[model samples]
Target: MTLLAPQPFRPKSAQLLSGLMFCWVLLSSAACQEDGASVNCTANPEQCGIDVEAVPARLYVDPPFGLGFGCVLMGCDEAKILTLENRGGGQLAITSVRFKEGSSEDFSFALYNDEEDPADEALEHPTIEKPLKIKDSRTKALSVTYKPTDGIADEAVLIIDAHDASLPYQDSVLTTVEVPLRSRVLGSVAFVPSTDTINFGYVAPDETGQAILTLENTSENDAVLTLAALNLTDENDAFAFTFPENPHANPGDVIEVALSFTPSEYQDYEGQLTVATNDTAQPLIAVDLRGTAFSEPGIRITPSVGQGIDFGAVRFGETDVWELQLYNAGGAPLTVTPSISALGDTDPNVFHMGSTSGEALAEIAPLESTVLSVYATPAGGGAQEGVLQLETTDPNNPLITVTLAVFGNAPMAEYSIEDIDFGNVVMGWQSDVVEVTIGNTGTGDLTIFSYDFEIGSSPQIMLGSAPDLPVKISPDDDPISFAFFLNGQSLGPANATFLLQTDAIDYSTARLDLTGQVVSCIDGCPVANGTPSCEAGYCAIGSCAEGYHDTNVAFADGCECQEERNGDDIGGNCSDKRDLGNLGDDCSDHAHSVTVTGNLHDAEDTDLYYVKMEDAGSVICDTFGDSFRAKVELISAPPGLALCVNIRASGSGCGGYTDYYDPSYCGQNSYSSNGSWSSDDDKEVVAWVVWKPDATPICTNYQIKFRADD
Candidate 1:
């Protein structure tokens, strides 16, 4: 059987359709051709229309790959149209059409008039009043609108029934056709979070980390997204997710969901979070949440808080050093800060102690240790106590303290002055009183049993004032004070002794010797190269002559350091550079100057000098002095021949020349290695004692030493 579609058919299909209709007519004429006489149905259908029950109308549908609304959002409308053609000779009446494919209300059908009925714009269900009518060789549009109500793949069978209305009830000539309808509906809007996956990074045990999941509606402004459900599945029970309270969201609206993760063990944990929303494209949003719980920092001290560092017996004025070990036993880095506690007044007998560990340590890697030194210096006797406190970033042991204990047991009397000299006194002249003090440098009390004085040749010196006959001195008590006087009555040198009898275990007596020259005060001090003055019945070198210093500060030693000025290199300018005579071939064959000790009063005190190298390939010099200052060796060229350039303008701590000096003060031409520049024009290299810019005093007290390297 050949079916001719009323749609836009191909030319070949139309030609084939005309041939089939002609063949059907010929077959009908041949059936009535008895006795060689043909009955034409066009003229008079005598036999063709004689008692015949023929099918007048038939239903035909071009599914065109089945009516389908691929995928659409819920509460949204998507429609498709199908052409129903009447291939029969009579008009086709589609009485009704229904959807039987998934029994889902999402898929529905309606009938609309063809181009012949332009006024039938409104969709109408196929029925007796608005039946889908397709005349012979005509077509009508059967519209199927899929308004998905659920988020699932669905299918529906469009059951269309058509028949000729003129036929009797028994011979209704009914036709039924099924067209497959398919569609998929999803949530009306979607949820976009701040992140698709939440990673808590490295979280330590017993620590909780949190992250936020943001929900945003990406649908039209009028469209709303309703959160249907939310859930989380965690096998380890280490994660907790909090769903947003408000379930409804519109376009441009944002929702936030909180999630927290806390791990009890040092292991990896993972969980899955599912959020159900009204997003047709993706109704369920699954996010992977992961985190790792690592071990925390732990501090272990060698001497625990209870057990302290004890120094058994330490004498006053003596120091004892101890060692402390700090260990980190956890998987993370630990930070430590150490401090010494101040001595408490409750204990009169206390020691002064401090830790070399200044303030804080940046970090200590896992399973590491560092050593700290603490020293205890006793200032009093008896049981001396101190504390060393350490603060660390360890959860288990944040603050750790170690105690220091020492005992002072012996007491020895110590005198402030071993001897007193009232030099050169006049007759009948009374000298100034010299105050003397006596202290105990031991653990116990020192008692002054008695006191005595021994005058040798002349009775010139005597006791001006003395402490009580018997006095007790404790290690912590203030030292007792007394006075001595020098009386000049004779003309000659005199000597005397003042002694204290104490109950000291080692020595029972403390003595102070006194001496003086009993001469005429009018004679004054015989100071060399300096003036003399008499004051307090004694002779003194009051002032020095010009260009001289009282270096020894004595009437006899006279004035020394007879330099013009304090500058080391007196001729310290470019015009008057100090020449450090030529050197020998050997490093120390005959050293012109082995070591020169000098102090740089200030940065401007620059000593510019040059040494002539003799029978030597190169000369290397080093500086040894105070570390605060930097010593610069400037290998200079005479005037501009061997230009001595202050590369870093002196005082610039460390630099190229200092690291390795080169004779090439001017830029090297061949760039042969570095700093070694020798001029055939001159042999003198000036070495300047300049300041290291920052630490000018670093090499202030420097011992400039030089030697021939080759």
Candidate 2:
């Protein structure tokens, strides 16, 4: 083995000067060579040692740790580039790049001169055949490619030898540079929902309800999510969603969406809520949104007075009508069926449902009401009770019952007069008649038993005419009349009680008070001093005393002024008949005959006589003719009596009989035998006539005898 020595060190300027001195010494070396035969040899090997300094190469990696391929899905490729720069003034040569001990298969790397190629296959523990050299301040790229077969966290280390040379004789050890590489392999982009389905249990048709659905981003990194569409599968459009405007979320972030359900009908409804998103695993998510729409009906009764229907105090055979209100207080339409019936002894026909047909159905909308009419007509008197049943489609209460009641009574007789006043009457005179009317105001018929003055009453007041007793009066019919008269006999004030008895229970006895005063006549007759006499509540007088007449029919005015008659004998008797020449006397008594004389002035100037008969009887008349043709007429005879006979001749004739006669009552009393006469030129002839009776009695008759004059 040869011993190695270091080379001699010399300054550049000193080396040049040494070279010149060597040349000069060679030129003078021949002349001084004979004298320098004896030159000394003092050059020592230890003193001529050479000094040599060694510096190691430095490698600077832009990233001390390898670049990170953040995250990649399985079977997908991602890459990152790392730079190696030579910071020292020496060549940085990479001999081999190798993974660390615990490196992953999913993490790999590659080296390139100018650019990075991510698609290139990565090498593990790879040795460079030719050393890669890098200059100072220059960079070299190492591309890290990650292709994950499975989802897991992985790391690797890429070691670079900067001092390694291509020749085996060169130095192989230098500064070691390490670049750490890391990669995370993700499975896939996923969207996880908080709930898979939303259920809105029950909702009303008129109302709306809502629910919330959360969409969470299950991806490991931030992701841009897109809400492509939101759809409702309900045909009725009852379900919907309130979509978010920006549908972006980071890892573990959540996006909330609102789901609403609205119903329109009264039946059950079903629907689905669909959401479209950008998630790779689940692009379109369908959330089952279920809801049911239901209806509840309610019944209510509103009566006229109380909670129940009541027809109070109705008369028998009369009807009373009322109204009841039904309300729908729920969210849906209500159907109602109304019926009415008597509960106990009352008749079924008494209670009736009006405004609706038999068993008719009624529909009421939500929060609305309907009115039903009811009528109560009692057939008999007394208390009546009934029930009104209403059936509806309400879930809570299907059947509703209401009580009804009514009271009825018999017809009542109402009197128009509470009292009667005859006013003042003179002595020996009578007062005017006062009338009292009785009306049946109740629902039934009323019968009057009797109407008369009370027993043991004063003679001053008496009944004018007896009214027919046991008479029937119908409800709302014309009233019955009763009259009373006052006789001016008593002194001072005279009082009498007129009592009415009826069949009606409510009006068993009705009494009216008659009051009058006996007054002394002012202008009538002389007063009796010794023995004062009063007759019929009036002062005794022989005839009508003076100017005062009983105009008011009060006895106080004894002699009333003669009322103007106008040819109508309203209150006149036979003795006071008017128009004596042209008209005959009106008979006051059917049993008595009156003689009336009249002259026939012309053919049209005939006389007429009237007889009001109380019993069936014949009327006899005789006419004395003067100069004109006379005609005798007996009209309006009794049913069996013949009509009046008329005789006509040049002068006079008196033996004319009725052609048709059937006198069966008195066999010998023939109508022909009663009349026979002859006509005379200048003498007066007397004509006689008689009327017979019929089966039934007659009340009125008329007779006339006249002459036809030229």
Candidate 3:
């Protein structure tokens, strides 16, 4: 009565077997069924009609489980292929292929429809919204790339979503797959240069010249450079190189190297400069160097013919010429050309130059010579100088100059005797002859016509002897002599001049001064108040008498004073007596006795008297004075005469002391009137006054009394 609902569809064989088994099992268990439970197919599977099965989805990657891009340099990119296969026998749908969580920024993923050329079928965008379909036993490709900005190891994974069409009945189901990616970034180094050669131009020997070489680094990292060795073909080690110490350069950095060249000889020089670095492409770099050395010329000049050429002195309007030689003492030829055109004053009249061939240029070969003539004509009288300049081709000295000097003089004449002096001449006498030397002290000759006294010259001055008239004296000649005399009758100084006529242009008539002094007869005599007599143009004087002296230096005063007895005043009232000891004189008279009165001014005063006794008698001589101490000395008379004296001290005011000639005549009777007269000659007696040096002036009167004993 209850019909069973249709069971799930199943295979025919399985359904038939399952139906038979179910009928038998139902007969066996019929008694166990309850009366109210009819055939219930919902709860019991044996009552079902058929059975159905569902399909499952599966995912497989072509590279199994991972993908890698290998190691690469920084700033470079690498790519790899990732494949997903549908192995579950159904249409596979990929919804998206993207980077998973915890993935790095250096990794990327993209989907491609083409299996053979995955790069050609890359998706425009990295993420995909439309699902991709893959049939059973088919595969899909994904493009994965790794790029880094820094040097580091990187790893990432790609996530894929795959769906199965057979499992469409189910919801929220997917096949998830991951493909791992990894990579490593590395640093690169390189080196480059701006140039590879250096050239040093012409350089002098032993002098250094330099050039520069530049180097650069083209790598993305830092690098170091070092110089190894610099080789040169120099015997004297003339080439050199200067490099930095352990140079470290960064990216895009440039360095400079200085290379110098110095040659020892005059020749061409060549060398190489090498630089080493840590570049992989090029480890060593070489630079070529070249230079040249040359020699220079020198110049020297000297006098050709002699030490120097002198033009001497010439007239103002005259011209003088001189010659000088130019010699080349160098290894090269010396070329000379006149530079007269450059002179500010190139007057041909003042200085003129001429060559042997009259050429403007002069060339002297090595060890050869040439002549240079110079003429100078002064414009006026005096010293003049000029210069001659020449230009040459020598490197050391390019210009040569010579100096010329000349003197211009006018006609002139001079005398060696400017003045003449006849010192002193006595009246009525001729002076000693004085010679005057006349010479030509000028540059020209002196022609003398005549010589005479000047108009104002005294008539007593005359030229006694001279050179003949019309005499010529050349320059620098020995002077000639001329004698002159001075005779006058007057007593005074006299001056005159002697005029000489000459042919000199400057001095037509030269005058020479003559000076002299005339002295009178009294002045010419040697003794004062002496009788002067003219003898042979000189005055002679007689000798002076005794007891008289001339104290005045002037000739006008004759014998002026009587001789004093001592340096101090011997006060005596004696007359001026100049008589010699003649028989007729006052002191020599033997007929009478002599008596005199005098005064003693000081102790040093002395008085002298003369006496003569005809017949021997008592000769008594006595001296009396007041406030005076007198000392008397009596000289012994002749052989036929005898004398005596008496000595005594009167008082404290005055005293008298006598000195006898002999002790036998000392007594009072010593002068007895007993001898006869032998000769009528006078005898001398002296008296002295005694006083102290400090005594005041005192005038003491004294008297000498003389009497013949009768």
Candidate 4:
């Protein structure tokens, strides 16, 4: 083919075109050369344009250019097959294609064609495959699988240092493709609750409740869910909150939390719970806790019946004590107020045992009870009754009352003389009479329908006159009478006693007995039978004739008068002495010098009567040695005198006795010693005595003579 085939010179336009073309070709070829080799080019600007800027080698990915999730596999997961197209204007030569050091284990790739397979050592330099050529505008596919560590970034860059033999080393291009670190996240997040809410109703200050949250795994993989926050609130200051457990959540995990609320100074309340977690878009979980709050329950009282007390069947002014009990059964403490009131016509102040109205009585804790006392005192004397009412706020059981009873005054009996005495009555004397007044001075009625006169071995005595038999006395009425009679025999100075009885009185009967007596002789004088004791040893049987020895002597002795002396019985010594004043031997002779003496002290006074009677000794003598005369003397006289006597003579066989007369002048005349005897003649002195009694002697000058002596 050495034939110089077309040396034929052409036109100048073609040559000029060739010269310009040659110059253009040279510059254009220089622009097209990678290292030093020529490249086919055209002189047209559009065809042979020179671009100095490095254009990144790109891929037209037909298959999975973007990262995708992987199916779950053994230890972890993997992601997919991918393809790339060489769409740049130049042929590409990939020298090394690999991931960075830390990212190398995250991916693996397989060439789409056998010729595109990079040698194993290609990853040593620039960390990729060995150098490989790809024609311009060609497609190169790969199967790329990748797996990323959990909780790490999911993307990485695959770097390829491409070199062309026609270009310099610095002129070679480096290509990188962003490949997502793929993972198979096969789980979703959900919220779970062990319980919705906890209601602690009517609780004390120290109480607690527990709530649990669970993070459930709906997929095949474990999930990490985080808790952001937790909240609790209440309506009043009555409640507070606390958390005793952690707020973390994991897939298929449950967390138990304790919530506590303490009520402070409040009655009722409501509370809520809020929990926030990272698993859901709206992470807050709300729970409502509710219950009724109570303080303590108290007892309210209202009396059962009338307020004014009427103690039925009870006497007035009677007092009774009652009781009331109350309880607090609620969860809190209760304060109680106890009051006393009388219902109906009764006065409030009439019946009272407890504190006043609105007085706080006691404070009771939960399940505690207390008792109160109420006193009811009536006002009047008849049957008094009323009701005791208690007031409180308890709606169910409000009021209460208690019945009262009181017994008042009863009647008692009274009598006049508690003691009586019967003197010198004979033994078995049955006609001894004494009167006792029975009266009922009290407000109650008394009855004395029968009369009973009880006596010791005496006949049944009549309380009234003889034949009337018995008497009935009434309250506040007059006195009653009774009599006992002697048994017609010798019932004398010794064995004398009796008692009067009553049927209505319950106590012992009224009785009388002798408590005193007198002896036959006095002042060292010999006494005989039926003889009165000598009055100062100066009394005898006969009368004291005119001008007798002393004016006190009852009789004259032998008519021989003795000389008189001025001495009187001073100091009561009864001895004759020469020391005598002008005092006369009269009753005034015993008086002191001055009736009103030194200091004028009062003298004890005594009034007495004594009988001096003639005995058998005087009768046998036929002379007047003993006499029957009652001596009237002043022991200690109170400026006066009282004289009276009733004597009975005991004669032998009821016949032999002394005949006596009542003598008028036993001593000096009744007037004085200086005066004459009111009787002048010698009267028949039988047995006689004179007295200054209002009952003068029946015989003014008579004396007794013993018939036994005759």
Please, what is the TM-score per model? 0.29, 0.25, 0.26, 0.23
What is the alpha-carbon lDDT of model 2 when measured against the actual structure? 0.55
lDDT of each: 0.60, 0.55, 0.53, 0.39
The C-alpha local distance difference test score for the whole of candidate 4 amounts to 0.39
Task: Give per-residue CA lDDT, model 3, range 484-555, as digits (tens).
Answer: 888866779878888888866567788889989888765666555345555655554343445433433233
Q: Of the candidates numbered 1 and 3, which has the greater lDDT value?
A: 1
lDDT of 4 by residue, 281-368 (tens): 5568777654333544545223333443333432234456555556554545556655554545555555676566557766765444
Candidate 1 C-alpha lDDT tens digits along 1-710: 12323222122233434342221243112223434555543233333332222335556676645776754544568777788776554567787788774566777665676634534775567785666667765778777788754444567777777777556434775667767777733335555777777877557888888998888877653455667787887787788977667666556777678899888997657689988876768878888887766467777776555778787766555677776677666657788888765356424334333434547865876656687767666665667677777788988678987777776545877888889998767666777789989888877778888887853535678877877878888888999988877787878888888777887655877777888887765454577767666664456777777755554355666654343234233444656656556443333344533334444433444445455443323345222211111122323211111112332321333223221223544222111111222321113344545444443232224444443332
Task: Give the candidates in order of lDDT, highest first.
Answer: 1, 2, 3, 4
For every model shown, the clashing-pair count is: 23, 29, 5, 59
lDDT of 1 at 376: 65
| Residue 345 shift from truth in candidate 1, angstroms | 43
Among all windows of 10 consecutive residues in model 2, the one with the lowest summed lDDT is 23-32
Model 2, backbone clash pairs (residues 3+ apart or across chains), number: 29
Choose 1 or 4, whichever is better by lDDT.
1
In the order shown, what is each candidate's alpha-carbon RMSD?
35.4, 38.3, 36.1, 38.7
